[model samples]
Structures are given as C-alpha cells and as structure tokens.
Target: MGDEDFLLDGRPHRILSGALHYFRVHPDQWADRIRKARLMGLNTIETYVAWNAHAPERGVFDTSGGLDLGRFLDLIAAEGMHAIVRPGPYICAEWTNGGLPAWLFQDPSVGVRSFEPQYLAAIEEYLQALAPILVPRQIDRGGPIVLVQIENEYGAYGDDARYLERLVELNRAIGLTVPFTTVDQPTAEMLEAGSIPGLHKTASFGSRSLERLATLRTHQPDGPLMCSEFWDGWFDHWGAHHHTTDVSQAAGELDDLLATGASVNLYMFHGGTNFGFTNGANDKGVFQPLVTSYDYDAPLDEAGNPTAKYWAMRDVIAQYAPVPEERPSAGSPAPRFEVELDRAAALFDVVESLGTFTAHDHPPTMDELGQYEGFILYRAEIDCVGPAVLEVDEVRDRAQVFFEGDGIGVLARTHHVHSLSLPRDARGTVDLLVEDQGRVNYGSRIGEPKGLIGAVRLCGEPLGRWRAAGLDVGRLDVVRRALRPVAPISGPSYRAGTFSLDESRDLFLDTSGWGKGVVWVNGFSLGRYWSAGPQRSLYVPAPVLRAGENEIIVLELNGVPHRPAVFTEGLELGHTEF
Candidate 1:
C-alpha cells in the first residue's frame, strides 16, 4: 500500500474498491454482498470495523454472529478479493457514536477524538482488544487485509498531531504491520493535519473535480494518487428529501478519475441497512436525523440487488480493469402481497422493563445517564392553567408530551417545534417522553447529547423535582407473550400481529400513516420509522422468516389510529426539492 503506485507483491495494482459494512448487512448475506461488489468489477473491498458493535459495554467484546470479523474476512479472501481495513476507534460511517462505544460515556468529561490522556487510553484499550483478532487476518500473516486506516477524516475536525502520531504508533505497537493511511479533503491543511510522517495520504471526494485530484498530487507527489471515498451516492435523512446521485454523471466521473491514473474506491458500492438503532444523525448546518435505511443510493440497493448505477459502473469499470465476464444473475424478484395485522398490545404493558427510573432536580441528558440509543422519559410536577405553554429549553431530537398519563403533543427537532400546549389543571406530574433518534455522527455537533438537557418552564415559572427514565429497547421479548390492553393509536403503545407464509423471501413492512415508533419482527428489531414524509417501509430479510409463522410488534410513541399492514409496492423514500 505504501509503494509508489501502490505495488502489491511488486506488481501494479489498480485498487478498484467498494465500501461494504459487515454490521449493516445480515451475517448470512456477507458472501452475497461481496459477490455483488466483485460482479461490479471491484477487485478490492473496504469496511469500517465498528467498535461499538464489537464491544457494546466497557471491557466486554462480542465477535460472534454479525460482529464476526474473522468469518467476514475469510469470506472476502475466499472470493479472492483484497481488503482495506479501517479500524477507526472513530469511524464516522453514519454509525451511532461514530463507531465509538456508548459505554465510553460512563466518563463524559473525556474529550473524544483527541490527544487527551483519557481519549488516547480509550482508543488504545479498544485497539488492544481488537488487535489479536485482527492481526492474524492481515496479509502479512497470509490474510486478506492489506491496508489499515487510522482515525477517519480527522482534518475536518482538527489538526491534532499528537493524536495522529499516537494512534499510528499504537497501530504499530499492537502488531499492525501493514501500511497505515489517512484520508482528507485533498488540501494542504487537511493533509498536514490528518497525515503522519510516514503514513500514506489519499483524497476523498464526490465529484469529478480536477482541482481536488490536483490537490492530492500536489501534496503526495511521490506516492500513488487515489480516491479513498469516491462518493458514488448519498445517504437519506428524515424529513429531508430522498437522496439519489446521478448514475450517468457518476459513471463519467469515475472514468475521468481512472483516466488520471488514480485508484478509486466507491464509498458504498452496496449500501446496507443500518439495522436496529445503529443509524447516526448528521449536522452540517441544521440538525438532521439519518433514516434507518442506510441504502446510500449506491450501485447496490439495501437488499444486495444491483441498480442502474451498478450496471453503468460495471460497463465503465470493466473497460479499465480486467473484470469477470460471468456474473451472477440477479435473483428472482420477491413477490409482494398485503397482510393484515389481527393482534395488538400496549407499550405500558411492559414499561416497567423498558426503563430505569431516577430522580433529579433537573432533567439529565442520555450521555449523563450512560445511554446511547432509544428514548428517555422526563417527569416533573408543576401547577399550570389551561391554554398555557410549557417551555423546554432544549430537545435534542424528539419528545412526546403527556399530561398525567394522557398524550397531549409532540416536540421534534425536525419540525423545529419546542413549546407545547399545557392542560389547564392543578399541580400534577408533567411527563415528556423524549426519543433520542440518533446523535450526529459527523460534522461539528458530533457529541451532542439527547433528552431534556435543559430546564423546563411552565408558563413562566421554573419547574423542579424531576424523575428521568431511559427506554433503550432493542427487543420487545421481555414482554413477548405478556398480555396487555389494546389502546388507541395515540400515546406510547405496542401493537402485535402474526402472519404465516408457505415460502419466504425478502420483504418490506409499510409504515405509512403510522405514528413514530420502533418495529420488531420475529424477535429482531428493524429500526425506527416516523410518519414524517420519507421512509415508509422497513426491510425485513428472508432469513428472519420461518415457513409457518411470523410475528411483528410495534411500539408507537404517538397516539394515532393506524392499522398494521404491509404491501409489496415500491418503497416510499422521502424526497426533497433541493
């Protein structure tokens, strides 16, 4: 990876690579994803090793199931494709906490992505745990992993040399013998800030801009010029329009970059789903929540099916690289049908198991309580008259207001709504069920906390005596068969239904006209959905289904009349005019 022109085994290697996250796709679908990339003419594969997915808690690590890197890499090697491993203790791959574990917040005073002793120690500890499992798979040890990336795109954040130097040393100290690389904006500032003394430098861009490539050449003239993250497509967001990159333009730009003799890596040749609450939010100028479907509008759709973009890129890339002529046929399209949900339940039936109660003078944020994903409840007693407005200083994501166990209104960051109408009544408990959709995984607002991190005022008076609770339900099994009442669609409620299929295939559950909530099918959580105009269907993989029966449970936070139904029609991806 370090040689001029990036010679591998003393031979010229044009790294036609594509990014594919193992955690994003199901464990059973790893081979299919890599096969699709290879069929698209990609000779190399790229992936970010999510630290949080591997170790959800402090001092604990999980590598079985979807977190199994060894099995994933072995599959890649078996396919005869090379690998570029990005083990960023800080991989900003639209992952929750930027791939950093939530348990790290047990000590919030520690500044993240910095040279602070605590931050460095945390990174080192994570690397130490991962190194043993990772090193044996490196090419040096006859594994497929050839190149390792340090902290991801750090120059956009700051120019911390000690941090970069220390991380590079740590990789080496932990037996990473492969060449280490750093990617940046292709400018002198980013190159200087993100690059180490001996590390290779690569440019990241989404367009066919000559100036960007020139900038890379100007800085790393002695080495191979490559586009580490040649952004072939984009990620979608809630309330924002669905993102779709022009495949024609992308194909032309890819050809242009290859003509310049630079190796290229498509950011996501196959965009996978951000299953569960693993999706990360974004903050460029406004706070936007990332959709559950990481479908990145890439060459391959979320379900490992190729798109028009995939075909276009394949035609152009085959002209440059010696691609395979025999490609796998796109499997038979899955049949679509309507299924009626006949059963139901309420969320309060299991609220006891959903959250841990705590008392506070003021509401605390998710970070304050060491929680990463899911919702939190804030309750305080206050006297208010009818038609009065309740002012909460800040709502990081979304909140549902409840007046003495009755749902009243909602506060979401997307709509920029803050104040909600209060009921005219005597002093009572004011409950705010706040949902931390996701923390911004990229940009300046990277570490913003969720929940009511500020004061609550009733009309004009400060309210006191608060109790906060957290609801991070990844599964609804604790009360799977627990019987509860079937309440209205409004308020926080859980609905249950069962459907049977003689045969199984990939499917989507339409959530249109439904309130915001989380969906669980056969004990696996599919992620979040909001009625906010964009994503309306949740991707349910085939393996999760059985021959006889299937079950679905929804925990909706808002009170609205909605029936559980699914259709095979096209997905309702939200669209924006811009």
Candidate 2:
C-alpha cells in the first residue's frame, strides 16, 4: 500500500493507532497483538523505538530474542496495518529516564534531550546506529512506517523551536523518509515551540474538543492537524492503586474525533512493562519508579491481552472506520509443562568467595573503578567507626551498611542524605552497600548522575580498598546464572511445578504471595514484580514456551516455599489464587 493508502486527507493520515512496545510482550504474541489492534479498528501500530531496550549498552545492540524491532514491524505489516515508528533517542515512556540507557549517566558532562553538543552528538550516534534497521523500512522502502515522530511530548519540556527544528533535521540527515511530526500538550506556546518545517504538530488532549486542534491551527495553521497522544489510559506508579478509565467516555471522545474527520492515535493501545531498571520517573518532584507492569489502563493490558476498553473503542471505531472482519483469538495456548523451581542458592556465599582486596581508605565512584551502572560496595577499616555515624556525602538513593558481618543499618536517601547512625563495633571492618536507582528520565536536569557519584566516607576519612560488585542486572540470563543469594530466601518459596500441555500457549506466572524480585521461565526473564502493592504477576508468552518440560524460577525477595506456584492460561494473575 502507498503512503496515501493509510492517510485520511492527503495528510500522512489520521491513524487510529495504538502504542505497543515490542519488548513488552512475548515475541510469539507479536502477531496476536497486531491482530488485536486490527480488530480494534486500529489501522496503525505506533511504537516508540526504545533506545535502551534495543541497545542495552553503548556499543552492543540486541535485536535477537525479544528485542527484535524488524520482526515487530514485519508483524505489523502482516496484519495489513501501517506503522508509526517513534524512534526516540529519548523516549519518555515512563521508562528509566525516558528510555535513555542508564550507562549514558556514566558520562559526567552528558545532558540529555538538549541542544548540548555532547548530548546531541550522543543522540546522533544512536540514530546512526539504529538507521540501518529502520531507514530501509521507511514507507519509501516499501515498509509500513509512514510517519516518524521527532521527539516525545517536547512541549512539556522546552519551547525551543530551534531544538525541535534541529531534531527534524537530524532525522532527515539519517534518511528517515516518512513525514515527520512532534507531539505536545495543546497549549499555544508549546504548540508553537514544537512546530517545524514539513513537520506536523499534534496535541495531546483528553477529549475530542476542537479547541486543541484550533490551538494547533492558531499556532501552526499550515501543518496537518492531529492528536499525537490521546490519553486512552493513565499509568500507575509503585505504590498507587491500578488506574482504570471510563471506556464509555473515551469512546465518546474518539467517535467525536473520527466524525469530524480528525486523525488521532491512542496514547497506548497496549502499555508494556518497564522491564529491569528501565522504568522512569515523572517531573512531579516525586520519584515514581514505574511498576514493573506497564499495563497503563490501556485498551490492551501489559500481557498483550485485550481489555474491555479495547472492545469498547473497537465498537466505536467500527461505526466510522473499516475494522477487521474477524476478532483475534483472546489467549495463547497453554504451555505443555509448568516447570517447578525448588530452592534458591545463597547470595552471601557468592560475595564471600568473590575474593577480597586490601581495605580502602575511601569508597570509589562508579567511574574510577571501571564500572558503568548499578550498585557499588565500599569496604574499609575505620578507627572512629565504632558506633560512629556513616555518612555518604550524597547517597543517590539507598544504602545498606554492614558492620563486621552484621547488617548494621539501612539508609534510604531518596529525599535527603546525611547522619545515618552506624552500629557499634570494636573490630572495624565496615561494608557499605549502595544502589543507583537510575537518573530522572524526564524534564529539566534529566542528565543528573544517579548511583554513587562520589566517595563514601565515615566521619571525616575517605573509604578505601573497596571491592565493588556490579549489579547491572538487565537480562534474565544473568539473574538466573548469578545464583549467589544475597540474603536468605525467606517466606513461602513457591516450588516450580510442571504440567503437561499439548500445544504452545501464553500463561501468567502468579506472584500474589511473593514480596518481589524477578521471574524466569526456562531462563526467560518475564520482568520484576513486587507484593508491596499494585502488580501481582508476570506475563509469559507462548512462543517462549516449549512443547515438552519447561522450567519456571521465581527469585522472590521475601518468599517462603509453601504451595506450588501455578501458571494459568489468562494474563490476569488474579484469576488464579496463589
């Protein structure tokens, strides 16, 4: 199909599209998701090209396994739908620092999403790296990608038209053939700020009110009008309850937009998980680590299962748009055998055997020690450390201090850092545990360094002779093979149980009783889960499931072996009581 084939009014088109990340759902379920989008009357599949997900490290990129973007596009094309690829060097999808690689914070001088020479240069490198995969698939290349987005919601950040124009120029320089666009809230100044040449401006409004369109027109009347991000659903943080929107209200607004011949894209038809440390925080002055499950109260849930909202929106769109004739199947087939995990190896053993070095006078920073991301361990022998105050000049977020083998104290510096009392000890061997919660992904100062930026000191002396442990926990293979249990596996340890299946199908790994940590099926990391509040289980795709016996492992932070953990056919873990 030609570019106009997907367009509504000589414009690239009003894609009643849904946002779904390829990394969030199982590779096996990609087709299912696209089919569901089609059934929902979605003619386009809009997705943010997550830089971090695609390139976990600076030089290393993985499109294999579940990170395959090309296969994802192929699936979208197979469903006869157009694709809107938002390849953001900075995608603020509630991802850690808005999809910025955590390692980028390692560079002290780097400022993200700005016109800063260092920042822009890094972004250019990222684009160049990703171009080989995307450029060939642009609409001109006979691929489904029709419209490419410039930056995500730029108006929310700055009104720098120069920066916006530069971004447009950057994409063009990289050979992105699709017409370009930018998304921002419907404000006069923001619309003006995000506008560029041959660049369409889209407003993110909650309703179908023409006011937002009028605002865009008043500012950039020469460009195509669109709703770049329609908030079909909202996202939930770690401690908040799940957010649910009124489908009827959303449907009414969507119907109104379509009736008026307007083009709109649902913010997320499916909001995938912010796997690993990829979850980001908003600029509300509150550190909101996105829940592992990014279901986002979307038309499609995190597990790629269609929600009531999906049907409601689909019915509404079917009235004005041409929807798929047949509905996609609801759930994947059940896996043949539900694998069982019995016990977890101890983490202390791994630490003890990691080999020791001479005690240091001062703690090391993330850079000096040749480490890039995650936690650092600082150990030292101090004279005044007995019952002395342990002071991390600036603990990025969390620190656990162990005095001579005993867990002395835990200090959470999420708000402020200082004066954490140390346990009394005659023999002065002090070990400080520090974890980098990742830098803020959105808004101003997004490039702030996370983790331990400086040295760790006790009283007035700098800590030295430290052996740092790099907990750059990103992949599932590492979580499984790095079986050194830090603390004891407590509470009810759910033993892996096996169940035979005739065909491959999707299943939800129930995590109701487990406190938190990660889950793996046959070595596939489903993502993290916490019993603290909100999310309960992780989704396992059928494609990853085998016909024979499969293994399921749950690395529970606070779980004791009790009943055998069960796997069900549905995506909702609540359906199966643990």
Q: Which candidate is the best by lDDT?
A: 1
Candidate 1 structure quality by residue, lDDT tens digits, 486-510: 5444467777778888977677778
- Per-residue error at 341 for model 1, in Å? 2.5
Model 2: lowest-lDDT 10 consecutive positions? 569-578
Q: What overall lDDT, based on C-alpha atoms, would model 2 receive against the true structure? A: 0.67
Would you list the C-alpha lDDT of every candidate in the order shown? Answer: 0.81, 0.67
As a whole number from 0 to 100, the lDDT of residue 286 in candidate 1 is 70
